[model samples]
Target chain A: MAIRDDFEVVASQVRTVVQRFALGLLVIAAFGAMLVGKADTVLVEHARVLALDVVSPVLEAIARPVAYANRAIADLREFASLREENARLREENARLLAWQTAARRLENENEGLRSLARFREGPEASFITARLVGDSVSAYMRGALLNVGRRVGVAPGQAVVTGEGLAGRIAEVGENSSRVLFVTDVNSRLPVLVERTRERAILAGDNSPRLRLTLLPSIAGVQTGDRIITSGHGGSFPVGIPVGEVVETSDGSVRVRPFTDFSRLEFVRVVDYGVTGLVGTGAAAPAPATPPGGTAVRSR
Target chain B: MRVDGTLAILDRWGRAALPGTVLLFFVLLTLAPLRAPYLSDTLPLLPVLVVFQFSLAAPERLPGPLLLAMGILLDLLLGGPGAPVGVSALGFVLVRAAVMSNRRYLVGVPFLFQWAGFCILCWGFVALVWAFTTLWTWALIDPVPAILQYVVVVVIYPLIAPLLARVRARDPLNVPELSRGSARPGETTP
Candidate 1:
């Protein structure tokens, strides 16, 4: 028994030693991967998308019940004011009918005007529909994981929106997934124009629910509850996408409340405008130019 | 339940499983997209607390390898463009290293000191991450969000600590086999 006890002690010590060595190796490997990822983010992105694709099914299965429960709770809240909601919807329908009639008349006039002006149109836009599968939106990081990615032609800098209005832009793309950086992310900024006044300003995110509007001309007229839309100055997002509405605050600090509630985001459309803006210009290339101050020469 | 005074020793796999499961659950919690207003920026430091509590009180189950894995996984899940990854792993290691140094004495310290220690560690970790992120991006990210997260984590720690203590208590497999004084891996004693 004494001999057996001594052998067990020795074996246990050996196991402990081996585990420590393995632990050290793993820590080193993990940190090494992190550094490599920092150096070349694409390497980590490939692995991330693969893992995301594998886990997407599991995450969806788990989220179903939570969505169901949330819907039920929301239903309960709405049920309490069903009559008020019906009246509100009726009023909105009436207003929309009037707007629709006006929009048709304006559309006819705009087409005539464009034809007279002979405007040049760019390539048509397409969209990729993706579900909001994961909410990795934290204070420090304001991005959500989408279920569709490169497999479906999703790419970085694509504009993501919901039925309500503009939501955010795709910041990174993976093979089977992507990350959408919400407009409220501190790192986000987009040029916007107020609808009523047509005044242009900068919409800046501070990781808050309300985005700030800055750089408006001192003479620009601003009002609370005014609509805002993308100015499309950078040629990334297409022009005139509804962004948000001006917020009411007593401090005279301008803020716009996003139309889409990010906390409750479930799905979004990723739009491909096909204009990368990387190329110097879209104008037709100049005809083969002669050598400066010299006649063109034949080359071998 | 015990038949007499003898505790039931967990099998090898069983002994290694619970802490991992718990830590993983916390990781999932960290990644879960909660839909509350202002929640995106102030998720309680659940993963950090798990590492701190388990590393301090239940190192037998949560060794260095598991902590490292948890950290790496968190880094992947929590990062995007302009976001720092690997900070979570670094933070977890920092806390684990701190705990390992004085774990024997810390194993049974009053809850207050543990809470205090966790707050300090969290603040330091946040600062380190913010600094690292600045250097990586060559720009200064607004520190307001990180500071707010630290505040939220500190405020919620007291309420969450008791439940974590209960979890640590349930992991009594780490308890010594006092009766035999040298129980083997598979053996059970008082």
Candidate 2:
């Protein structure tokens, strides 16, 4: 009887110890979570960035095969569609050939006019072509990773473009990889000008496919179908890079239809411009003329 | 006899080896490249495996600290902005606690019911976190997929449960508990 009583007491004691330990752990977890919520430190960002860098290569290696497999599957699915669109494509091809001939004639005429006026041409910009390796289109972040990085001379803040037009700029750089933050990311803010009116506005993304032209006053001369281009006011992006066309919504808010189809993004061109150094020496030296009086020129 | 010895060695190693193997599998899964055509939004199969293992094993033998460490490691390894591993581990513990606390009522229940409960608990935890964090709202916008995945997990549990149970049967810590109850079958102790 005494032994049984002693066993019961010991069992109770053990239970109490376990309960106390569990409670202590819960308290610690709660406190730690609270601490994390309160502080937005550079240390956390650095840790996250480092962790991403370490994992990025592995992800890239994996993403390539997945992307290839997906392409194969998509190709198989599109075979029927391709056949249906063949006739349309042939007609389009003929039209494009005629348009190309007309464009060549116009370009020759323009060159003749420039030669007669003795106008000096700007230094030619170079480009490094790259393939899109991976993309993440999460609600909070929309970005893509490219195969080219610092070794390929692709640096952060360098603009990326496709045949269509401006995509976005490189936000993060790695040795073998670089992340491009699309113009549709919530954090992306680009200086843009209305191609028709030369009205400057800041194009900002609110985590949507469409980007908003903010800071355009109510009296700002903006209209639907107005082409948008890099204003070069920030000096980060080159001037006159095609951004998008303006579309006015029913609510009267203006948005941009980006030139590059982000959904079908595959190949991109990273402009091989040298890094802008301190006091803009490397950047400013290349562009000496500002079309006189710094007034925006309307393209005829 | 050699087979017996090999089995014995496996049995001894099973305690740490099993969980380690599961963790490695998850790491490999995370590293596995996902192609575009494959389902990317589905929850990983690892968490379900962990929960099922915990349910089949003797709770006292599996150290809580080890489980917590596993959770922390998973959180660090899996790239999420929030504490998915921590929350997942906590969910496992809570589910285990509930099962153990009500073992008498649950032990005789159909394995399907037990699995359904386990999946429901997991889904609830994930949904709670999603709703609270407000992240991945679009992915979970159609809750049907989430629910369907939960059901699929539950369905897969029965297949995995028996194998896990056999593994637990060989566990040294579990042996004592099993032996205690079966040594004198038919002799009721009051």
Candidate 3:
């Protein structure tokens, strides 16, 4: 019994000591991570890339059921509204047919005007469709994973969109997968213009659902619900892609309600507008699809 | 030192399995964002919750360093936000330290205070995240969203509490009797 008590005491003391050491080590580790993060070491980044490469397939497998469920839900909703949807589509088609006639007239007139001015040709815009397989949805960060990658001509700075509108841009591309940096991501900034007044502003991400517009002239004609579109100023995105509608927050600060419904995202189109020397992870730099004379593509 | 052979084996695997499952559970949870009806773009930190649970009930199983490592790994797993690398790591460490310092009060306390303690400790964690993000961006992120996220997480704790309790109830690793045997602490075997 005495020996037993001694052993227990020894064990307890040793355990306490070890616990303290572990705590100290944890504190050190916390500091170490901060240092490493700030350092942005190439080796550490490559390791993270390798780790993601391994995990993405597993994430994709998990996403399959989710995708199925989403599709099933959408189909159910569509079936429920079949009659109403058909009526709405018929009306929309009729309206579009009339608008199409007007737009064709405008197109021919614009082409004649452009030809008379000896205008250069626009860069060809092509798209690669990709499925979202994973997402990092923390309060601080927002990005999604795409199944397509450098293998499919997906490159960093390539804009990603949905049927709704601009969703995000490809930030990092790997061999078989890539990450889309959402417009709401803190690092994202795109040049935009108010569709009405043509006022230019920088749409900045503050980790909020609505993006904040910076550098808008105080006297510029921006109003609630005004449509914002890309200006194609920086060669990042082709001009005229619908971004969002402007809104004034409760605090009187301006924000944009993005055209894309971020939560319901399933698939996105990766659009290459051919900006060469943009940020990319590709080892072999591919030439931009830009035509000579640096004529920027105009996207819909 | 050996008890029932099967129980020993279960206990042996349970040490790694329990914490690992908790870690993986949260990581998976984070992959989907909670949208509007709840706070948008906000996700409850699973590792923080798991670390909080272990620090209160079974500090020996998790260890502060393990929590820290898990935090760092989680941060690495979702790296686009520009959050400092060690924010989660440090947050978990702080949570562990907070729970450990008050483990005596927290462990045997009523469920209310235990949860309240978790809620209180979560503020510091959220604050650290907000402060770090502000530093990273060189701009102040509105504190309302971060505070809202904390409130949401606090609300979620009750729902998660039952799942954790279930995991603990079935835990073979840290049963009181198993904790007191000749195997002692620091031995991989419980």
The number of the candidate with the highest lDDT is 3
The segments of candidate 3 whose C-alpha lies over 4 angstroms from its true place after superposition are: A1-19, A41-44, A74-86, A112-117, A218-220, A223-225, A248-254, A278-300, B1-11, B33-42, B169-190
Regions more than 4 Å wrong, model 1: A1-34, A116-121, A197-201, A214-219, A248-254, A277-300, B1-11, B37-40, B158-190
Candidate 1 docks with a DockQ of 0.31
- Cα lDDT, model 1, residue B4: 38
Could you give the candidate ranking by lDDT, starting with the highest? 3, 1, 2
For residue A215, give model 2's deviation from the true position in Å. 3.2
True contacts kept of each: 0.38, 0.07, 0.57
Q: Write the per-residue lDDT of candidate 3 for residues A77-146, one digit (tens) a residue.
A: 8999999999999999999999999999999999999999999976989989987887876676668888
User: Which residue pairs in candidate 2 have backbone atoms (N, alpha carbon, C) closer than 3 angstroms, thus clashing?
Assistant: A66-B35
Misplaced by over 4 Å in model 2 are: A1-40, A105-139, A146-148, A162-166, A218-228, A240-248, A257-269, A276-300, B1-38, B42-190
Q: What is the lDDT of residue B151 in candidate 3?
A: 79
List the pairs of residues colliding in candidate 1: A139-B41
Model 1 Cα RMSD, 1 decimal: 9.3
Q: After superposition, how far is residue B168 of candidate 3 from its true place, in Å?
A: 3.5
Candidate 3 Cα RMSD (Å): 7.4
What lDDT does model 2 reach? 0.58
Candidate ranking (DockQ, best to worst): 3, 1, 2
